[model samples]
Target: MRAYHLDAPRLDALRLVDVPQPRPGMGEVLVRLRAASLNYVDLAVATGAFPAALPLIPVADGAGEVMEIGPGVSGLTEGERVIPHFLPDWSAGPLPPLASRRMRGITMPGSLAECAVVPAAGLVPIPSHLSFAEAATLPIAATTAWRAVRTGAVRPGSTVLLLGTGGVSLFALQFAKASGARVIITSSSDAKLDRARALGADETINYAAVPDWDRQVLELTGGAGADLVVETGGAKTFARSLNAAAAEGTVFVIGFLSGGDLEASLFPIILKMLRVIGSNTGSVADLREAVRAIDATGLRPVVDRVHDFADATGAYETLSRGGHFGKIAITLEHGHRAQL
Candidate 1:
């Protein structure tokens, strides 16, 4: 089998090499990977910002077919399609301590290869409606968005404010719309905002044009502000997200694409009686619920770019450029073209 190994922290250290095909052990399943999607955290891993063991196969999200089922794994069989959960330990309910440190790409070998062996407990059946590339985008981005929206307890006709048109924000936009919530999406690019509008974003703000976009959000909501804010921009935008959030609303922290550290006051949080929730990727139950919702709504993940397996490094570079609007996927099967 072929795999990409991060022998060191630099993206240049990511090397493609042949490795022995792994056989499933007790309670584990061997996946013949079809596609894997890159996340911002993947970039962090490549740069050593996220600690990982050396010679690690780095990528947290993948979708493929079950080629072999290990002993004691009864619910899955060979030829069944499945997606690997990013965090193997946090399978359900509240996240357990130290689970993030043990996440697939961070502490364990991930699925950026032709084959991967994953615990059966962390695998979710892929919906029949989605292709491998689409299913590959689910485990991390989609599940995190699911947790964020559900944490906000968004109701019908409520408002959701998304920081950007990235994977998580786009997923949040789609899910919020599915739940009958009005979505307000922000982007520096007008073209991206237009795209968000097409995806059912009730209002789109070019944050670059309107630097005080939170005020625009308040105006759009008749000065009440958004009921939920998916704050992916982190330090650069967290304070504004707090400004744009309605009293008693929730600002779910999912990403730090703009950098993690923030210089902000805690006064708004107290004055507005707001809740700031830090959300990791998600649990297995969360993934299951997201899969059901995607199946029911026929919602498709927004894939920004698809790179051939040989160009995995280029895929990482693309993600680093921050030019992509949604998930960037890499196809692993030889001659298997990714559906962009």
Candidate 2:
């Protein structure tokens, strides 16, 4: 099987190499990966921002068909379309201990390969309306957004504030809208803000133009502030996120695109009685609910571009450049599957 490996903690260390295809262990399933989507974590691992065991496949989100099931795995069958959970050991409830250390594309073998062995329990059925490329974006970004919105209790007449037009923010926009909440999204580029408005954002702010964007959120909400703020920007934007939340509102922190160290005040959280929840993507069960919501709402994930498997490195470059409005994917050619 062909796979991309990072022999060291550097982007240049990532190389394509032919290696033996992995096989399913007991209670696992071997999936012939058809498509994968790039996330910031993928870039971080490649660039040494995130630590990982060197010389392993790297990519967190992927979708494919089950080719074989291992012993003790009974619910799944061959040829079923599936998306592997980023955290294979976390099926439901609270996150398990040491789960973060074993995430796909970070500590273990990821989706940047022709085939991957995933625990059968960690596989969720893809929504009937989505293709492999679309489902590939759900494992991390979509599930995180889903968990954020759910934790915030967004519903009719609620107001949602999303920080940027990244994958998680856009998915939050879609999910919040489908729940009948009004969405206000911010972006550095006006063009991206316009695109977000077309996707059901009730208000859009060019943060580059308005340096005090949190004030804009407050003004848009008639001084009450947003009911939910999905905070993707850390350090630089965390203070503003705290100020932009309604009293008793939730600030769901999911990313650290701007650096993780915080120099922000806690007065807003204390005075407003705000709920600041930190989310690590989500569990396999959460992914299942997210897929169900997508199916129920007929929602589609925003895929910015799809690269051929051979150009997998190019996909990483696109994500690193930071202009993409949504998920960037890689599609594998399964022409040789018959030979397997």
Candidate 3:
């Protein structure tokens, strides 16, 4: 099978190579990958900012059919459509690193290959409504959004503020709307804000033009501020999120997509009693709930681009561009089931 590997620092390290196909080891399942999706992690892995990573295959979350199961594996069947949980451990309710050595697309070989051997426990059923492209993006982005909203504890009609219209924020928008909360999305670009509004965002801020978006958020929410802020912008926006949040509201710390480095006063968090919580990718339960929500509402992933598996490098570069509004999918050949 041909797989993409990051040889060293530069993304020029990405190259196609033929390698032996893998078989499920003990407690593992061999999946014939149908599709894989890109994330900031993928870009980090490729460019080598991601440390403790072995020189290995790239691309994390994906969807495929179960082709073979290893000894002791059960409750999984052949030909079942499945997605690997973002974190193999912490299966039930919360997020935790599963084992000392297992995290797909990171500590281990991932699904960028034509086939992959994953722990049987990682696979979850893909909903009937989604295509391979849509299912591929779910385990990471969707689950992060799920965890963010859950941590926010927002009820119906509560205000939710999201930074950037990236994949996670878009998923957050959909889930927030489904829960009947009003979404306030911020983007530097008006065109992106327009698209966010179409997705049911009650308010939009061009944060590029208005740097102190928190004040704008305050004015928009009638001075109480947002009930939650999906703070992906990290240091650059953290202080602002603190300023923008409603008293006692939660701000889920998910990313530093804004390139990090911000200055802020500690008074707001001290006086308002706000919570700043960090969320890794969520649990299997969160993924399942997100899947059920998508199935129930027929809300599919918003895919901004699709590239053939061979062009995976170019696809990774697009994600760094920050222009994509949603998930980027890469299609792979079937390694298990025969196509007619």
Order of candidate numbers by TM-score, starting with the best: 1, 2, 3
Candidate 2 RMSD to the real structure? 2.6
Candidate 1, residue 262: how far the Cα is off, in Å = 1.9
Task: Give per-model CA RMSD.
Answer: 1.1, 2.6, 2.7
Q: Across residues 170-284, which tens digit of lDDT does each residue of candidate 3 receive?
A: 9999999999999999998899899889889999999889999999999998899998999988888898999999999888888876665667887988898999888778777
| Model 1 segments more than 4 A misplaced | 99-101
Residues 1-340, model 2: lDDT tens digits: 8999889988788898999988888999999999999999899999999888778899989999999899999989899999999998998998888735479998889999989999998999999888899999999999999999999999999999999999999999999999999999999999999999999999999999999999999999899999999999988999999999999999999888999999988899999999999988989999999999999989999998888888888888999999999989888865321111
* Tens-digit lDDT string for candidate 1 (294-336): 9999999999888999999999999998878889999987957
> Could you tell me the lDDT of residue 303 within candidate 3?
86
- Best candidate per TM-score, number? 1
Best by lDDT: 2
The per-model lDDT (C-alpha) reads: 0.91, 0.91, 0.84
As for candidate 2, its clashing pairs are: none
List of clashing residue pairs for candidate 3:
89-98
Tell how far residue 217 is off in model 3, in angstroms: 0.5
Off by over 4 Å in 3: 93-101, 260-262, 334-340
